[model samples]
Target: MNQVIRGLSVTTFFYMVTLWASFALFHAIFDKPFDHDWDLSGNFIGLFMVSVPYIAYGLILRHLENRPVRRAVQVSLLTVVCERVSIYWIGSYFAANGYGNPIPLQFIRGEAAPYFSIPYIFIGGIVSVLLCVAAAGVRWRKS
Candidate 1:
């Protein structure tokens, strides 16, 4: 029980920090606010931020002592929910503060997630699951 909570908390923290740090990096490098507009740099940063956290999360779970494979997968799915909601909340925060375009927030809030980002989310989830599975497979082969 404690382990599951710790896993979720750590991964979610990674997700949030990664998201914020990417935006900060974009603003620093481009000298402009990140407004959810996918200019060339934005596209790369956005995709990288969306996908890397899941990989990191899966790796963390894989290395955690005594973490079961099933629990790892479950926590990965939960992070998807966390990611989507964070997008909405964080985008809204940016919009409200005049740091971003509200158009993206309108689309996200109306539909529960930006339509364009859904595929990336699934890809991240799939990668996370694959990492978990591969870790278990290696253990099984040794036994």
Candidate 2:
């Protein structure tokens, strides 16, 4: 349990660092703040940004004496829950600060439900973990 918690902390730290750095780089190149919802490319990059942490998390836990699939599922569930909560909180903060919600307008307008995106995220997490496992050649058998 403690190991999972520690792994999550490290994963989250990397995610934030990568996110901020990506934003900074985009700003430097474009001479403007990156609006994550302003274009399709932004959304694609956002998805990639979210996936990278899951891959890292899987790699971090690969050495545990457990099944790879189990570890992968853990990484998926933890990341998805955290990601959803973080999005909601950030959107709320932006809205409260008069910057407007960062969440897509479709969600706010009832054209799409935010919760519906969970399955896609979960699928992405599974794929990311599997990629890490394959790339690292992590053994599934318990030690």
Indicate which candidate wins on TM-score: 2
Kindly list the per-residue Cα lDDT of model 2 for residues 4-117, writing each as its tens digit. Answer: 677668777877776676666666767764443345335444565656766676666666535655756665567667766666555556556666445543342222222224
True-vs-predicted CA distance for residue 32, candidate 1, Å: 2.5
Model-by-model lDDT, in order? Answer: 0.60, 0.56
Give the candidate number with the greatest lDDT: 1
State the lDDT at 99 in candidate 1.
60
lDDT tens digits, residue span 1-143, model 1:
67668878877787678767776777788886554454544465656555666567655555665655676677766766676667767777767776645665554433333233555556655665566545533453354
Pairs in clash, predicted candidate 1: none
